[model samples]
Target chain A: MTRWGMVIDVGRCIGCQACTVACKVENLSPVDAWYAPVVEYEVGEYPDARMSYLPTLCNHCTDAPCVTACPSGALRRRDDGIVLADEDRCIGSRACMAACPYGALHLFEEASGEVLGDGSRGRPSLLEPYTAAGRIPGTVSKCTYCAHRIDFGTANGLMPGVDPLATPVCVVTCPAECRIFGDLDDPDSRVSRYTAERGPREVLRPDAQTGATTAYVGLS
Target chain B: MSAPVTAAPLPQNVFMDRWVLGPKTQRVWGLNHAIWFTLMGIGGGVFLVGRAFDVTTELGRVLGLPLVDVVSFVLIAIGGVVLIADLGRPLQAWRAFRNVKASWISWGAWADLVFLTFGGLLMLPDLEIGDSTPFSGLGWESEADGAGSVMLVLASIAAVVVMLYAGAVLARPRSIPYWHSVAVPFQFLASSLAMATATVLVLVVLDGDDVTSGQAVTLAVLSAALAVSMLLHLTTDKEAPGKKESIDRLVRGSSRTTFLFVSLLAGTALPALLALVAAAAGGARNALVVVALPLLVVGGFLLRLDTLKAGIYPPVTMPSVPARRTRG
Candidate 1:
């Protein structure tokens, strides 16, 4: 009954992409496929102008449209509320990509992780190992909230979000301490407490009505 | 102060079209989808009309197939091939049939399969090709009428599913501003009917046959409904995120010429008007049918293309502010 969720305090996010880079390194995601991206933005007129960051990733919705749209039964929601895609079953229809509202999913092509001779996104990539693993060409890939680490940690008798070993790399790597991940089902959990304090916890594209698990704190 | 305001809208994504605050058109689906959808619509539409009229005019002894059967089978076959080709993984397309309970594409795969299999069976009596024909002896002219009748019904049912799938798949994406409407399915359904009628009329004429006044009138009506559906889809909640921008893409953006001139004015409206006049004026009906049917069919193609082009994703950020500004 642990409904895993994440709370992002955008008020504290300083546009630093440390979490983005950390997630890339940990997930071994294609270099262009951002599991979590800190979108740098400028707002207001010159007098009130300011630079801000809107860090975005898969919301892992309870009623995920991508899961419903996936023709091959590739995408599924775990009992813990984590949405995942079984790359093997995926037909590469891109229906999940077309259906995702938060722009969290990406289609994997072998060339996406290509290394150039100029040593830019080249040889030293963590991708070489991942490509040999679950990275199936022509299938879809997305954030799992570090499900591997979660399962690994929990199996080893550790708590996620509380223990560094179990937490999503992006949440743990955020220098601004803007991200908190924990079970929303438990009122005592850090993620639940943060929401109670924040009160009117909001999700991006609320009109989508996908029951988004990732809650945000700032923007205006 | 009242409601949260986003940073002034970001300009369109120019650097390889990454991200933008403005509506971003989905480029993943384009010409392939347009052709595939057009063929699906025509196949379904034409099959419906052919079955309704029972036009059994034989083409040749090669397949011994009639005009309508050949048209529907060829188009649907080509569409299925195109759909498979369009996939990021073409060989694994069989997995598309597994999730029909949830996915439209799954339903489409099943529908397309049922349509082809049963429809192929329905068209079976046509094979006077050689001794290789298993259904060679069976014919509507013979006592196997009941069995043939069952195949006809199944094929017709599958045809309807194929037509509906075309729109339903596109409409499933709620994030898309233009394609999310209920009107899309109607537009596709109506367009399919109109295209089918036009195709039938053209084929009937080319074969030197005359359609009754009633069939001509139906064509007029179906084309008019197509026009209305197109208009309804075009006019939606313009205030919603990416909604107005989607409209701009049609009215003033790069798709302007195709939207206004090709689809709306000539392809849709003009065809409807021509069909009406042709139906009303009696003798000149053939000439007008010749002019209008092709236009209606072409317009149907553009409708699929333009609507596909019109889909725009709203910016994901909600622009919520903390109770007090912290950083700035």
Candidate 2:
């Protein structure tokens, strides 16, 4: 069983938002909802100041608080150790979203109506296509590791044509190639070896016992 | 030109006793609370009936009582009314469906309506028709009867949802941390149950019962447990900045002492002790249960009210800090 994880080398990242755009397109995320976001932070002052860009997505922790907090059993871990949401069972309670310390999950809202240039009401239509049965409005949506593409890729014994494993889209679309993704269970995997060779810092929320899978290397 | 100097006004701190809420929103929340209380009361009553009917072997006919069905109907009705009342425009509540993709409140409302209609339909056959009479020939039938077995199951499910919905409403990310815990639903359910038990004890006492030993003891134990849980939540967990400060103030101030001593000890503990003594003597436990019941109920109400008020703070998200080189 492959335990998927990612290694983000912040030292090499340029802060370009190509990954964010790619992720939005690949995941079909709604406007204002980014599965992968590049957070920029400024350091020092004046001429000597520097900026750091950290691309954040779901950590997919071993002890995911979201999974435990979901009362309806809508959020679950897949066989390959990926946290997935069963949209059909989701009641849109947003409890899982609250439990996530990393603010990864986004409660999606379908487009209700279009607004004219003068702010007048326009026609309303269903925005996103249903991916599962019994999926209703007002439910939480989040990064699914591009599970659909992953499944398709695994079945075809090839890399996903449409960015399967969604492997953190921001990482894949990075012009600097600072992001690496692979099975953490495999010692020789690119991500595993990279982290093993260069110590990486895992983001830890205070008092939260979640063991985050995503690691950041060469970050102060 | 000579600059004119302005005198600085002295700052007067205003103490807030009551917070004014929008009329419609306040009405919605008020109705929501009332409906939930009523449903919980009916559910508790049904459970009591089940205990009475089932535990007593001699009451064979009552064993098959429609207590559950009646409670289910009542719950559905209460839930329905709450959903309707929660809407901005009661008449145009159906517009809620327009944002089904993004609004949990709207979805939950629809679910409540569906469940209520379904549960009510299942309970129709067992509804009891009670004769109502006025001065002369005026009469009416009360549709409170239902098969206890079927109604119990439905009511139990609905009750769980009700509790979940209460918690879920406040469980948004980057929102109030006090309401963001996974234990919120459980806390709500436990408090609601405690309230129901207290209410029933009150009714029992008003009906001339002079003893309430068992009920009093239960209330005391539950109140203590709730207090402990609340304390743990406030102390151990990492809370939002505003919430933490407010809770700290509440606990350190006179509010804590008043709530613990007057509400918990005097209201709950004393009555529980009295009830225990009465029960031991095999005397009028009914009287004790009655006295303690009101106290317990009041204490529980205060507990919830204080917690809610104390935790009223806007949520804040800290700006991300840049990773920097530290002095080695």
Candidate 3:
């Protein structure tokens, strides 16, 4: 009954991009591949100009368009509400990419090193363990909410969101402490408590009716 | 004096600059899909029109071969190859047939296979292989009767479905508003029909026949309908935020030139006008048919390309800020 969700506090966010770097390093994401990126924009004129940053990732909607759009059924939602793409099942149709309103999904066109240097160099050594499925080419990938870490943490009797090792890298590494991740279904969980305490936090594109699990707090 | 009556602080704009979560999705489909859909249109169009016109019975033959059968067979075959080529795993395309309920793509794969199978069967009599078709020993010529007509009809049905599949695939994506309309399927269907009709007109004209007035009328009506449908599809009320943005991109943004000029004007308008001319003249001017045919084909292509180019992923907007902040 664990419906994993995110509560991003935009007010606390400094747009440092440390979380973006952490996500890339943790996931061994390809160069220029941003699994979690801080979107910054300037508001108002010079005297009153205020810089705002909104870090974005997969919302992992309850009713996911990517799941329906994927012809191969490669993108599947787990019981805990985490959506994962099976690289083996993927046919590189990019249908899921088209269906994703958030643009979280990305298809790898070439290897990470090949783009920056000679094609002779292979994947980064850090990616060796994760590259078993060869997701670096012709396969669509996105943030999985650090499912591997979550699974490991759960197996070791650790609570995600309560433990540093169990939570997503972006959540743990946010120097501004802007991210809150926990089970939304659990009333006692941090995310649920935050939702109850905070008045009327909103999910992105609520009009989409995707029933997105991720919510934002103090977006101002 | 209450701290000298200082002015109230500026309340922060929570939803500043319409910031939303996630970046815009890049267009997944490219030249491969464009080529595949264009080929499918031509193949499907030819087969459907040939069935309607009874090209097998009438129009006799060019060099002792039924032109419709040969042309449709070749086009369908090439289209099928192109479709398979676009697949990430060509050998595993059979997996698509196992899941008919998945998407238009699955159904489209099945439609192509069935259409090709039945179409090949229907073309058996006119194949002219003469004891070299591997199955010539089975006396395949005798099978070209009631069963042949049934297979042809089935093939035609599958072909029609194939023609609509491209638009159906595009329209299914909830993110792209421009393609999300009831008009998309019909517009694609009409374009395919127009292209096929024009192809037929070209053949009729080249064959020295002024007896293609019926086809010219069909072409004229279909092209005009296509033009109207394209206009309506682009201008219709888009309730979805994503769709509204997509329509804006098409009508007034970067895609405006291609959408207004190539797709609508040269592609749909001129072809419709030319078809009308052919119909009015009782299909006399083969030159008019010749020019109009390519225009319809090119116009239909430009329409598809423009649609793909203009497709905009939904914009990220500011997630609503809480009415009140929590201490946690």
Candidate 4:
């Protein structure tokens, strides 16, 4: 019922990868994997040219194609409408990866020299210790809206505490506060109010009918 | 030079004799190519089994037996073994799971594994149980009652994935136009089915068993439908650059014409006609069905081999154009 989503005000984005870095630190994601990527595109030519930066992550669509494409049921949507991955159930099929339109999912692989207690090395680990343990080899991963933290906060009837290490490093590190994440169901939430005041455009991939929940605002 | 006439300097053509084909061409035809061919062949075998099952289910009474499953399972097993053995690091194949984001080849391997496992379960009942006469009404103790049904469903799903994987792998961004279309997957699926039916027909004949006239006719009809669909898909659209080129290559026979025409048409069509004639004679036409089987098998293999070799690289222009222009 909580419908987790993000509102990226592209007008405010400066193309600096603060959100990207924050995401890496908060998620404890691999050095190469960026849970939130800010893609820069230049239009026109020379002096008259203009540039725009679009930050993209899991769209968490109402009809997520990745969900249907998964053969092992590893990818699922929670009761609160947050799409998440259950690493243990993943068989490493990658069907969901192929199905993703936004290229949001990052297939996590183990870093070199990082060995598990079971003697397995080079397996994927989320940078944050709390989420790292759930990473598995041959499996796909994507944004979870910090569901673990969100659940904890909900239980205590308080604002979700950012893991001193994980509180969505991207949201905290944003120099321009371009990326905003919150419960879309909460009328007073920043993301909800922003969407109501200035509607944002959702990124749509050709041939994919999934209606993405993540929206970008002020991109003409 | 003529005036000097010093043995005419022993013709420079001698240098031509030392020239050998380039390694790139050889590599294209080497082990990796063989693996591709072998995969297609195995796919053909699976197609045959599916066809045989369809035929037997429709005409078992006429044939006085349902032997299609028996023959199909054998061909499928043989093909599966060939594919698995062809893997470069067959032992360490489990490592394919390292990157799910970038690889469907790995997923294909897993699908094949599931297919083989479930296929074996389905075969046990046919091989060990031997007809319903002995194990009749065993009250849930029967093989058919337990793992057999479950395995059948699993194998069916895996088979669908197996059919689709070839197209999905080739449909990556910027690949040749021929392999880019959504229709490509369906095309592969159809062709594989046609090829598989043909393979089963051949094996059935080799087993010294005759297919019923009705069953043969049905299979022939399906084969014809598959052939027609293959042609239509190859010719209809010219939008996707990769797909158009692939279709052109298939039609012109530059690389795979011989395989496509001779093997697919000659092998499939000849037997299919025989089957049609046999069907017209009611259930008495066993001879024609026998003759059509081997042709179908060979034709199916040819179809698979051609499709696999008609490989296309991704569009490198946008990504690598600057380097090429500089070199030029």
Best by lDDT: 1
Local accuracy of candidate 2 as per-residue lDDT tens digits, B63-176:
232434444446556655665554322454554443344444544555555555544454344333453212222121222334435554654455555444554554433234
DockQ winner: 1
- Residue B136 displacement in candidate 2 (angstroms): 31
Q: How does residue A73 of candidate 2 score in lDDT?
A: 63
Task: Report the C-alpha lDDT of model 4 over A1-220, residue by residue, as the tens digit.
Answer: 5666777777889977777666666666644456777765554568878766666677777777666655556688777677887766665545565456555666654452255545566444334463445555445678876666677667766553233232344665778977776777787877777767776444434234465667666644
lDDT of 1 by residue, B1-328 (tens): 5998779987655322553334456766788988998899889888888756656453222366677878888899999899899887899999999997799989989988888887787667666656475676665542148877777787788899888887888887787867888888888888888888888888887777776677788888888887787777666687677778888888889889998789888998898888888878888888888898779878889989998888888777534332222210
What DockQ do you compute for every candidate structure? 0.48, 0.05, 0.27, 0.02
Which ten contiguous residues of candidate 4 chain B have the minimum total lDDT?
A: B319-328
lDDT of 1 by residue, A19-83 (tens): 88898899888656888988766677689887777777899998999999999999999999999
lDDT score of residue A157 within candidate 4: 68
Pick by lDDT: 2 or 4, better one = 4
Candidate 3: clashing pairs of residues: A220-B14, B19-B317, B19-B318, B20-B316, B20-B317, B177-B243, B267-B299
Q: For model 4, how does the per-residue alpha-carbon lDDT over B1-328 read when each residue is reduced to its tens digit?
A: 4666466456454213322111101111223433343344345345345443554433222122235544444445564555444432244446544445544555665666777676555544333333443433333332246655677677667766666665565454222344445655655565566556545555555555666655666667756765665566666765443355555556674755555666557765666677778778755466666666566656655655555555433221111122111000
Please give the C-alpha DockQ score of model 4. Answer: 0.02
Per-candidate local distance difference test: 0.81, 0.53, 0.74, 0.55
Off-target runs (Cα >4 Å) in candidate 3 are A111-113, A117-133, B1-25, B57-66, B83-99, B131-146, B238-254, B283-285, B318-328
TM-score of candidate 2 chain B vs. the reference? 0.60
Q: Give the TM-score of chain B in candidate 1.
A: 0.87
TM-score of chain B of each: 0.87, 0.60, 0.82, 0.64
Candidate 1 residue runs with Cα over 4 Å from true position:
A111-130, B1-22, B57-62, B131-134, B137-144, B320-328
Give the C-alpha interface root-mean-square deviation per candidate: 5.7, 11.8, 5.4, 14.8
Model 2: per-residue Cα lDDT over A94-145, one tens digit each: 5566457666776554442234445555554433243233334455667776
